[model samples]
Target: MKSNQFKIVIDDTREILKWISHISKWFFPLILAKNIIQATLPYIHILFGYLILDGIIAKDSSSDIMKNLYWMIGLNLGLGLLHSFLTRLLNVKTEYIHHATKAEIARKAQTLDYEELEKKESLDLLRRAEEGINSNGGIPSFCNTIGSLITHAITIVYSILLLSGLFIAAPKENATVLERVFNSPLPTLLFFILFASALFLNFKISEQLNKRSYAFFEENVDTNRILNYFGGVSNNYNFGKDIRIYGMADMIQEEMNQKNDAIITMMRSLGITYGRYSALIEIVNQFVIFSVYIFVGIKAILGLVSIGSILKYVGALIRFIGAVSSITIFYTQLDLQRQYLNNYSLFLNLENKKYQGTLPIEKRDDNEYELEFRNVSFRYPNSPDTVLDRISFKLKVGNKMAIVGRNGAGKTTFIKLLCRLYDPTEGEILLNGINIKKYDYKEYLQIFSVVFQDFKLFSFDIGQNVAASIDVNEEKVWKALEQSGISERVKKMDRGIYTNIYQNEENGIEISGGEAQKIAISRALYRDAPIVILDEPTSALDPMAEYEIYARFDHMVSQKTSIYISHRMSSCRFCDHILVFDKGRIAQVGNHTTLMKDEKGLYHTLWTKQAKYYN
Candidate 1:
């Protein structure tokens, strides 16, 4: 058990260092130099002060005293400047590490399997991980704590070295009993034992404090998430209308106040506990200081050590004991940081169950990619009911196909499976002849452009949105806009293709739902993949606007294999083939005329009902 825990600590330490180095390769080396300077400066001042005092008391030459003073002042100024420069540089690097960690977390989320991402467990884990990061101040705080620990250790070592002579020197033969006792090695041993005991007590206190802190964070993760949601929603423009209409402001305020009060109460309790421990620590520290003064003063009175030496020894002993206590506190802090980091570590280490195949997708100039679902069945993760059960169909190359179904008819599930968002629970989907999973995940996705029902457009400029990248081709973007019938609307804007979507920035435009749908369509057209699938992206548009999209879609799709999913039965009449889905199964497949001939068929029933409603 101990070995396992040791290995975990080693791994977490390595992980922390890995991120530090990854963010800035020179961080550790420069921070070490900075710490060394920080540790040495105080000792230099102590030693210099002792030398000058002794010189003055002993009637040494003025030239010798002035030279020593000059050296000390010059060294401090030079090293201090270097330390300041390094500190500023390391601060910027630390900020980079802090922000980059958030970006890395987002990147990890995007790359995770869609199935895994959908689970509540994943979201809860993410919340806990973020809490840990916030509590520990992320990697930056950990790095700083370790540097402080090193500095304290260095100071202690230096103190020990300087005071060794005081411990080993012999007392004068005519010394008093008390002076002899103080001069003996026993005082030295007693100081060591006292320092060790103080350190042990410090560790025990620090452990309790850190453990309480960890518990507070752990117990409040859910509450904090709720608080964050309420906080964000209050500021969200999207929720403004509902909030105002429902008069939710007072309710939200009440919840916020309650949560804030709870957190404050817990903090007050924690602070009280800290205060008590702090008082105890101070007492221990004062006792050590008293012991040091008596030991050093007795030697000074016996004329065995100079007044300057007494001052030096007392300062060294106090600093040495303080360093030991600080080291204990810092080590416990490292342990706390390690615990916090475990959440983020576990989150990052989550396995991607979906196989990422290495084989490159076959490229063809003719744009004739064929897809076949061979007895594919799927159920969402941890779901008992199957969404798509033993459904099999082949999409014709370069042909327009329409899938018409009622709500909960598995139309979207089929699209999701074809898009490889979730792998089939049984059988497999084939591209050309080989299983689709055999092709590289990213490479396979490149073959199709899909506009889902709930597609999102960012707050970027229209050109970048269409291109889906920073390097936008203005010509291609305009062409796509024209094809999608939103060019005229875009042309009217002052910035035209450069106009920003949504009111997220200065001079940004808030487009209508119809305009947003057109932009989404334009984005798909810009991709110009071999296969185009529109899963009711036109739902937000009016009847005429939706018709216009379908009307221009053929010219827009050109020679690509197009799959259109819609609820309007009349709109699908233009397609050569139609699929009718019912209860997670393909109940019928035929052209409109062919299916309309069968009066009792599901397609005929749907078409007749829709036609009657229009009439």
Candidate 2:
């Protein structure tokens, strides 16, 4: 147990030092100065008081007393100013460190492999790390705990220095044997033993309290996640309509209440246990104080120490015990905070298993990126079933292809593989005769622009959302918006392309579903990559509207490769090539004219069924 505790202290201390060095080189120096000044402030005042009493007893000159008085006041005032200034600087640095830590976490999360983002283990790890930063004060808590440890340690040293005379002062020759024993160095050793015992008791109590508190934090992760989800739903205006129309308010409230009740019960139980431990610590503290008084009083009675010495020893001993107790408590709390930092470090260290090839993609002006899925297959992580099985296909430059099938026909999985969101579990994907994995992952992704079925737009301004960047080109954004058929609606807005998408701001306006889809399409268009993929892009639009958008997009990307995915059969008629998927394989591949002739084919069957609805 002792070894493990020491190991944790070493590891956590190293971690804190690393962050302090990385975040701000001056953070440690400033914190050290601030803690030193804070800890010495009270000691200085105590020492001055002791000096004043001693001076008066010794019949010091009135001028000398006044000088000492003036010096004390001057030093205290100056130290106070320095302490405040350092504290302010530390606070600013602390906030910067906090924000920097959060940004690092966010950056790591964004750079994670798409597959990892979907894995349950990775998701839980991310949540724990984020909760540590967002809710638990993260590195700031480490800073504060470190400060407490330093301040208390300095206080302990100063107190021991002031009280050293109490134990070291020689016994008078006329003193009785018992009084001599009490005044000898033996009494000092015994007092130290007593103080050590008191500290030990306090340490044990503090360890117990920290354990309970950390356990509560661990237990609350899932509870807080659920409660936050519900809380978000209640606050989100998007869910307002369903909640009111379906009378789900009671259900959500009931779920929230249950989680809240469980948390409250746990908190109350923790409070009770903590109260008992605190009482025990306080009892130990008082006992130490009483022993200090008795020891000092016996020395005073023996005429071995002056009246001023008794007061100084008593005061210093009290401060010493208080400092020792604080050190124990803060050490335990620092360890608790270390566990949270460990979680954060674990998340940052999660390896990206996906190969990020170092080879740069050759820049081409002809937009001649050829892609092929050669016997590619994949199954989701931890799933027994393959989502896409032996999916073989090839794409020529500027070829317009339509992928059609019912839901769960591996259509979206095919797109995901083509986009290299997940590498094939078997076989390989090739780009321009070279394995796609050989090309730089980021550069390879730039070959295509995809508008997925469940695309999302942030609450940024219209132009920003369309361009997916802050540095938007007004000409390109307006062009993309016009091509996606939302330019007129945007032009009518008070802020035009600068207007926010949702009610995230007072001037922001909620857009219709079709309008949002158009914006998503506009985002895809703004990229103007060699290949454009529309995956159920027009699902929210009517059949006529869907056909119109597809028709305009088809012309807009006539020179570039395009892949259209839709349930509406009318959209596929304009495509030069079509691929029909069923289960996890390509069931059919041909053009609209050739595939329509085979009435028994999946394409013919789906087209005929959907055609009846439109007719």
Candidate 3:
């Protein structure tokens, strides 16, 4: 194993030990006592059998001998019952501890960053965590196996001691023949070799099976995405009619079938591999057992050993083989668990490189704040071309700036930089003559309230979703709703603001796309920040509703710094400044009237093309 692999195994062992220490403090003494009682009972059974056999062989059927034998039998039976009860009690206690530890690990996983979880490498690690928990049914089972293996090893030692005592006591009898027969080291060594080979083969088979299982899991994840896409066709209000007219059900079903067939083929191949290895291991185990039985039977037929001595030797050998097998199996399981721990360790070590230096930003004393981009340039991580190239512009506080651009004109990328989602690749962005980098990230985000076209709505109450992370009052929530022109629709509902918005759960009420967008806008307004960004917020609404929403936007955000992005040319009429972006640079900048006068400008070409629809 590599050094890192060793470290991960060591960490996992420490985790296991921590759990063991906790359970031992409370239940260890009880477990140890129970195991001792269990181990003692097996010897008690052996003693009872020895006394009865001796009485029969000697023809001593006296009343005292018979009575003593009956008492021994009763005591042995009681001890057996006690052993069974304690085993069940230990199993239940171990299960409880396992579930508690799994819960703690799951909670720790949830605290990880959302972006880190979305990475491709992280997905496989997450899958391993799932499989590890499933394989052992939780952490406690892993620990319980170690404890039970230890207990069984102790039992094996006790059985060997009892057998040795029996051989010494029967030295003059034919029963002493078994002690001489097994005393040879050659037979014991052969048994160990065969069993070890079989165990190693079994481990190889199980590891291959686990690898195939994970491959199937990953393929199913892709299949689920396809299913979700098709399931939306019939219920999507915007696309349902188009789908019905096109009759796309057969096409989608065929695609889904192809994905399913691919998974089935991989599973069949795995099953074949597992079957071949399993059969070979089973045959080897059977051969080892047959050889042991043949050698012992020859001695008994030759009158070299008594029937009782032969029975005792066979029992001891079986118990020893069983203990060795259990240890081998546990080691294999430990190896598999270590593989999962390594994956989890990788996930926890995901890179989160922090920005080195901070840029200074002047605090605004007045309501107005000036923003500037000084030769700003930027590119996304792992991408070659710059999305914004040497772009420079200025916006006065409380000014409504309309940014218009054709598709792929770098309009959205420019806004993303202003929001500081990704820092500039080359140049700097300034707020009040200070680099925005100097301000705290969270504090900087608080300066603006934005609603993008692809905004997400969580499965929460309408009011809570809008006033995100803030203590919301009913009066303020309703006021924001009223300002966004969605209060009338909300007031008509029976549950009003408290109604859940997801349709999958009981009592959840689903709203229209336009209504969802309005709720998003209401959330942005509730923030009451100085800067507001609306990226095509009214795209899903009707023409009349869209115009009315923009009219309300102008009134409600009158004295705030507003940046509006839209394909609709008419929306730019109310803005004090309009910027037309071409490729990754600013092509033109002026008020609507001036831009309209320049026929060669990109904005003029776009407006002329749109004006044809009205004509």
The candidate that achieves the highest TM-score relative to the unseen native structure: 2
Lowest-sum lDDT 10-residue window in model 2? 132-141
Per-model TM-score on C-alpha atoms: 0.94, 0.97, 0.77
Clashing pairs in 3: 98-140, 359-438
Q: State the lDDT of candidate 3 residue by residue for 82-179, as single tens digits.
A: 87887787688777655654664565466554334545556656655555555444444555555555666776786576445333332334444454
Each prediction's RMSD to truth: 2.3, 1.7, 5.7
- Model 2 CA lDDT for position 37: 88
Query: What overall lDDT, based on C-alpha atoms, would model 3 receive against the true structure?
Result: 0.70
Give me the runs in candidate 3 sitting further than 4 Å from their true place: 1-181, 200-245, 291-316, 340-344, 356-365, 469-471, 611-615
Better of 2 and 3 by lDDT: 2
lDDT of each: 0.86, 0.87, 0.70
> What's the distance in Å from true for residue 496, model 1?
0.8
For model 2, the stretches where C-alpha displacement exceeds 4 angstroms are 134-136, 613-615
Q: Give the runs in model 1 whose Cα sits over 4 Å from its true position.
A: 1-7, 594-615
Model 3 worst lDDT window (10 residues): 165-174
